[model samples]
Target: MDSLSLIELFLSALRFAAPLILAAVAGLYSERSGVIQIALEGFMLFGAFVGATSAHILGDGVAGLFMASGFGMIVGMFYGVLVLKLKADQIVAGTAINMLAWGGIPVVSKMLFDVTSNTPALEASERLPNWVPIVVALTVVAVTYVLIQKTSFGLWLTVAGEKPEALRAAGVSPAGVRWIALMISGGVAALGGALLSISLASSYTRNMTAGRGFMALAALILGKWKPIPACIACLLFGVCEVAQLKLQGVMIPGFGVVPVQLVQILPYAITMFLLAGVVGESRAPAKLGQS
Candidate 1:
C-alpha cells in the first residue's frame, strides 16, 4: 500500500480501536480489583442506548455522553451491590446484567421513540466532537496505567485482587475498593458505547456493540491485564476489523468474490484464536473471582 493508504489504514485502526481501548481499560480496573468484569457488554449497551437517547432528547451530544457515563455507573453500582452485598456470583450477575441491557434497551426505546430497535439518528452537529471519543479513550488508557503503577489506589487495587486480606489489614475494605472499581469500569465502558453511536455511527441499533465488549475482554486477557499492553492489543484487534471492512468484496483467481460475511468475522476470529493460545500464559490476580 502507498504511504497515504497506510496512513488511512492507521487512522481507521485508531477509530475502530477507540471503543475497544475504553472497554478494555474499564475491564482492567474491575478485574484488577478482583471483580470478574463480564458485564462490560451490558455496560456498553446501556451506555450506547442512554447516550443516544439523551442526546436526542437534550439536543447535546456531550451532555448525552455524560448522561451515558452516569447511567452506566448506576448499572455498575447495581451489579456491584448484587455481587458484594448480596453475595451473588460475579459471573452470573454480570451475565444477567448483559441480558437485561440487551432486552431492556429495546423496550425503553420503543416506549420513548416508538421504535423498538433503534434510536433516532442524531444530526452531525448534534453528535459529540468527532475526535473527542478517541482522545478520551486513549486518555483513559493512560490514566489507568498511571493509576495502576504510580499511585496508592493502584496498590490498593492490586492488594484487593491478589491479597484482599492484606488490604483489610491495612484498614481498608476490599469490598469498597472493588465496588468503586466496578463503578469506574462501568463509566469508562459506557463512554466506549457512547462513541459507537455519537462518533462512529449516527444512531443506536440493537446490539450495536456486536460483541466488541467480548472482544475487549479478550484484549484484556491477551495483554495480561495491563493498561498499555491491553491498549496495544485493542489496536491490533481494531486493525483486523478495519481489514475486514476494507476487504469486503474482491475477486480471487478461480475463487469468485470474497464473502463479506466471512470478512466480518475476522476480528472476532482473531480474538478467539488469541484467547485460546495466549490466555494460559497470562497471570490473573490470585484472589480474582473470590467474594
Candidate 2:
C-alpha cells in the first residue's frame, strides 16, 4: 500500500477501535469489582440513542455526549440495585437491560421523530470529531491503567472482588465498591455509545451498537482484564473491521473479493482462539457473580 493508503488504514483502525477500547476499559472496572456487567451492550445502545437525540435537539455535541454518560450512570445504578442490593440474578438482570434498551429505542424514536428507527442525520459541525473519541479512548486507557495498577482504590477493588468478607472485616463495604464500579462501567460504555453516534456515524439508528459491546467483553477477556493488553486486543479487532470495510471493493489476482461474512467472522474467530488458550487462561474476579 502507498503511504497515503497506509495512513488512511491506520486512521480507520483508530476510529473503529475507539469505542471498543472505551467499553473494555469500562468493563474492567465493573468486573474487577466482582460484578459481571454483561449489560454493557444495553448501556451502550441507550447512550447512543440519548446522545443522538440530545444532539439533534440541542445542536451541541458535547452536551449530548455528557447527557449520554449521565443516562448510562442512571441505568447502571439501576442494574447495580437489582443485582447487588436486591440480589437478583446478574445474568438475567443484564440480559433484561439489553432487551429493554434494544426494544425501547425504536419505539421512542418513532414516537419522537415520527420515524421508524433514528433521529435526523447530524451535520458535520454538530458532531464530535473523530479525533475527539480517539483522544478520549487513549486517555481513558491510560487513566484506568494507572488507577488499577498504582492506587489505593485499585487495591480495594481487588480485595473486594477477591474476598468480600475480608473487605467487610476490614470495614469496607464491598457492595458500595461494586456499585461505584458498575456506575463507572455504565458511564464509560455510554461514552462509547456517544462516540458511535457523534463521531462514528453522526446519526442514531436502532441497534447501532451492532454487538460492539459484546466485542468489548471479548476483548476484556482476551486481554485478561489488563488495560494495555485490552487496548491492544481492541486495536486488533478494529483492524479486522477496517480491513473488512476497506477490502469490500478491492480485487486481487487469486481472489476477486473477500466475502463480507468471512470478514465479519474474524473478530469472533479470534475470540474463540484466544479463549482456547492461545493467549493464556483468563481469570475472572474470584467473587464474580457472587451476591
Candidate 3:
C-alpha cells in the first residue's frame, strides 16, 4: 500500500477500534474493583439507543451524547445496587441487564419511530464528528492509566479488590469502591455505544454492537487489566476489523482473496491465543467476586 493508503487504513482502524477501546477501558474499571461486568453489551446498547433517539429528536449530537452518558450512569448505578448491595449473582445480573437493554431499545424504537429495527437517520450536526471517538478513546486511556497507576484511589481500588477486609480495617468501604467502579464502567460503555451510533453510524440498528462488547472483554484480558496495554489490545483488534473491511477486494497473487469470515475471526483468535499463555497469565484481583 502507498503512504496515503496506509494512513487511510490506520484511520479506519482507529475508527473501528474506538468503541472497543471505550468498552475495554470501562471493563477495566469494573474488573479491577472485583466486579465481573458482563453487562457491558447491554450498557452500550442502551447508550446507542438513547443517544440516537435524543439526537434524532433534538437534532444536537452533543446533547444526545450527554443524555446517553447520564442514562448510562443511572443504569450502571442500578446494576451496582443489585450486585453490590443486594449481593446478586454478578454474571446472572449482567446477562439480564444485557437482555433487558437489548430487547427494550427495539421495543421503544418501534413504538416511537414506527420501526422495530432503527431510528431515523440523524442530521450531520446531530451525529458525532469523526474525531470524537478518537478523542474519547485517548481520554479514557489516559485517565484510566493515571487513575489506576498514579493515584490514591488506585491504591484503594487495588486494596479493596485484593483484600476487602483490609480495606474495611482502613476505613474504606470495598462495596462503595466497587460501586463507583461499576458506575464508571457503565458510563464509558455507554460512551462507546454513543460513538457507535452517532460517530460511526447515523442510525441505531438492532444489535449494532454485534459482539464488540465481548471483544472489549477479550481486550481487557489480553491487556492484563492495565490501561495502556489494554488500549493497545483494543487498537490491535480494531485494526483487524479495519483490515477486514479494506482488504475485501485487494487480491493477493498466491493467497487470492482472503475470506471475510477469517478476517472477522482474527481478533477472537488472537484473544484465545493471548489467553492461552502466549502473553502470560492474567492476574485478576484476588478477592474478585468473593464475599
What's the CA RMSD of model 2 in angstroms? 1.7
1-291, model 1: which lDDT tens digit per residue?
A: 799989878878888899889999989989999999999999999999999988988999888889999998999899998898998999999999999999899998999999899999998887876577778888888888888889999999989999999899999999999989989999999989999988888889999999989999999999998999999999998888887876778777898888988888888788878988998799998888996
Q: Residue 99, candidate 2: how far off, in angstroms? A: 0.2
Give the distance in Å from residue 174's predicted Cα in candidate 3 to where it truly belongs: 0.7
The numbered model that scores best in lDDT is: 1
Candidate 3 residue-wise lDDT at 91: 89
Clashing pairs in 1: none
Winner of 1 and 3 under TM-score: 1
Decide which is better by lDDT, 1 or 3.
Answer: 1
Instruction: Residues 18-63, candidate 2: write the lDDT tens digits.
Output: 9889999888988888888789899999899999889888998998
lDDT at position 13, candidate 1: 88
Global lDDT of model 2 = 0.88
Over 4 Å off, model 2: 2-8
TM per candidate comes to: 0.97, 0.95, 0.94
